[model samples]
Target: MPTITIKNIPEELYEALKSTAENHHRSINSEVIIRLEQALLPRLKTPKDKLTNIQRLRAQISPNVISADDIDDIINNGRA
Candidate 1:
């Protein structure tokens, strides 16, 4: 196996990672490996597919004024 060394990591980020590892009952190395796997995993999506979906959704909604508060409420409540 090839050895990897990470350099110049911020102290605050290191502390956060150590805390997260402790919370999940995992070693720092294990936690970092899991995080790296998640970050590097390929997401399946074509640019055309994403644009088509966005356009279709936009067509369904009226081009009316929407408030920031309304958007926040929708996100927080996860409902209409």
Candidate 2:
């Protein structure tokens, strides 16, 4: 396994990581690895991609108006 070394981490971040490690009963090394995974693994979608997805989903669903009476009816009757 390749060893990684990080330097010049801020004191506040270092203290927070230490506290998080203690809270989760993890070693500093394990906590760092988990933090790295959580930080790096999510693929951020672009605004255009998000808008396209919303438009596609909206196209598939029919638009309908829900009146206050309809909402009250559903709340009272437990059915729509």
Candidate 3:
């Protein structure tokens, strides 16, 4: 395996990476590898597949009850 050293990373970004690594109970190197793999992998989902997933997720949650007013409020806030 070849090792590489990256220099001149911004302090904020390095800190964020360190924080994320700590949150996941991984070393910075391991977390970086995992993130790189996720970024590189292809996730091919069709519109139908996405809809099916949404439906499945909704089904998994019991008694999904959000009022129309709540929906309207969310839309209004997003528009503002």
Candidate 4:
């Protein structure tokens, strides 16, 4: 394993990180690694990915739903 030093961390931020690390049962070093990974990781979602999500959601919905006008009226009424 490699070692890295992070310098000039603000007092408030350091305390928050220390608190979070203790709560998660991780050392400060481990907490920093976990937080860095979460911040750096990129989530890729294509159109196909979105389509699959839409299909899944649609499948769970019942047929013979209310008309668009009815939905619009309901939305407009909510603003009043």
- My TM-score estimates for the predictions, one after another, are 0.51, 0.50, 0.59, 0.51
Q: Tell me the deviation in Å of residue 62 in model 2.
A: 33
What are the per-residue Cα lDDT tens digits for candidate 1 across 1-80?
Answer: 77799999999999999999999999999999989988998567899989999999999988757888988988989864
Clashing pairs in 1: none
Off by over 4 Å in 4: 43-80
lDDT of 4 by residue, 6-64 (tens): 88999999999999999999999899999998889856889999999999999999986
For candidate 2, which ten residues in a row score worst on lDDT?
Answer: 62-71
* Deviation of model 4 at 9, angstroms: 0.9
Q: Over 4 Å off in model 1, which ranges?
A: 42-80
lDDT of 2 by residue, 1-80 (tens): 88999899999999999999999999989999998888998768999999999999999986667878988988989853
Please write out the lDDT profile of model 3 over residues 1-80, one tens digit for every residue.
97878899999999999999999999999988888888998678999999999999988887738888989999999999
Better model by lDDT, 2 or 3?
3
Clashing pairs in 3: none
Among these predicted structures, which one has the highest TM-score? 3
In lDDT terms, which candidate is top?
4
User: What's the lDDT for candidate 1?
Assistant: 0.92
- Against the true structure, candidate 4 reaches a TM-score of 0.51
